[model samples]
Target: MTLRIGVIGTGAIGRDHIRRITNDLTGGEIVAVTDVNAESAKNVVSELHLNAKIYENGHDVIKADDVDAIIVTSWGPTHEEFVLASIAAGKPVFCEKPLATTAEGCKRIVDAEVAHGKQLVQVGFMRRFDKSYRQLKKIFDEGKVGEALVVHCAHRNPTAPGFSGDMAITDSFVHEIDVLRWLLDDDYVSCQVILPRNTRFAENGLQDPHMILLETKKGIRIDTEVFVNCKYGYDIQCQIVGETGIANLPEPQSVLMRSEAKLSTEIYVDWKDRFIDSYDVELQEWIDSTVKGEMNGPSAWDGYVVAVTSDACVEAKHSGGIVAIELPERPAFYDQGNNKVL
Candidate 1:
């Protein structure tokens, strides 16, 4: 049975999802769409030649009879309401990260989902579906790297136009916030942010080259360097220091070119290029699981925890002090033990 999907926010990510659902994947079709920019939505519908109706707003798309499920790719601030509406309508929704712009907003979504008595929301944390990350996770789980001690991560971007002071933590580093928790199967206890010098390329009062220090409940230390004006290429690196051995993410698989007295491999320009396959895998899995009346990826609780942790990190960034992450007890509704190894 083809799941009829309604998509909100026909921006870059939203349009990409519509393309994936309509052209790249199976068991799903986008039947309705709405965006704050109606022209963009119309253009996407026409450009893709999609047979979908343009609704007046996101709520109308959610209420459309033909839309069996919902996908929220709108602005981060608008997520809580659309997701809650989907839950109230008893439809599964795939929400892009932040879940909401704030921790309290995320908690509201969690409360609504719990009151509905089932899991109907999945957050788009696609790194978990990356093949390389999965391989690293498997190695860690198998004790190939016996008892991870510390993790060093780097998230680099070629250029960041709108990145401002706290966005280095809230917007860019948030991915690490979620994936690290999944990798260690542990929750964060405290966070601290360290700022080095800023790059001349940074604009709009954005701080570049920030370091985030996180401590897990299990006493593992993780440090991430978020450099938005790296100026070279988009690079993501993670190295796990363990008791017995060290494991790291393999460099992006590109053909090595030896010419002009240089050895080189291509670097992706953005997340869209770097993790396209991971996004495809994540969406395909979501489709398959939703068809089976379940969800098999990051839950709403995961989104909430990341939001809470991110809030702490933002506070740490501003205050120049270590901030403690205070997370509520995990609810029984989420099946915590179902995390798959590899």
Candidate 2:
């Protein structure tokens, strides 16, 4: 049975998901789509040669009877509204990051879904679907690495054009906040941000590289370096230090060439290219699970926790001190997500 999907955004990420579902994956079809710019939605249909109904507003897509499940890839601020509407309509929804602009907004969606008495929302944190991370998770779960003590991570990019302010911590670091919690199966207890020397490449003297220190409840220390102006390439690195041994995230497949007595491997310039396959796998899994009447991905609870974590990070970034992450105890309904960090 093909699940008729409605996409709430026709922007880059939304368009990619539509192409993936229509071309790469199975058990799903793009039936309805809408964006803030109506013409953009029409262009997506025309450009992709999709036979989908274009709507004026996202709510209309959720209201359509043919749309069995909804994908909320619209602007971050509009996520909560469309997700809540999908839940009220008794349809499953796949929401992209931020979940909402604020942690309170994310909690509202969590409360609404809990009230609906079903798991109907899945967040778009694609790192969990990466094969390298999956392998590391399995090794950790099987006790191959003993107990994790310290972790070093790096999130780098060649350049960020319009990025400024605390977006390095708020916008880009949110992905690390969600995925690391899942990788270790632990919740963050505190967070602190260190603004290192600024890079001249940053727009308007923005803080280019920020070092984030996170302490888990179990006293595991994790330091993540967020460098948006590395002037090299998009690079993501995670290495776990354990009692017995250490493990690192495997690098992407690339060819090695020896030229003039020099050897080098290609580095990805765009972030999407680094994890394109993971995104495809993530959405395909979401589609298949939704078809089975299941929501086996990042839950609304995870989204709320990420928002809370992100807020704490932002606070620490400004205060130049550690901020405790005071999160509510996980409700029983969403414990399924915590069990395996799906």
Error of 2 at 152 (Å): 0.2
Q: Give the Å shift of residue 117 in candidate 2.
A: 0.3
Per-residue alpha-carbon lDDT of candidate 2 for residues 249-296, written as tens digits (9 for 90 to 100): 889989999998989999999978998999999999999899989888
For model 2, the local distance difference test gives 0.91
lDDT of 1 by residue, 1-342 (tens): 889999999998999999988888999999999999999999999999999999999999999988999999998889999999999999999999879989999999999999999899999999999988999999998999899899999999999876766887777898999899899888899999998988889999888899999999889999999998899988999999999999998777999999899998899888887998899999999998899898879989888998999999989988999999998888887864265311
Alpha-carbon runs more than 4 Å astray in model 2 = 337-342
What TM-score number comes out for model 1?
0.98
Please give the lDDT score at residue 80 for candidate 1: 94
For model 2, what is the error of residue 181's alpha carbon versus the real structure, in angstroms, after optimal superposition?
A: 1.0
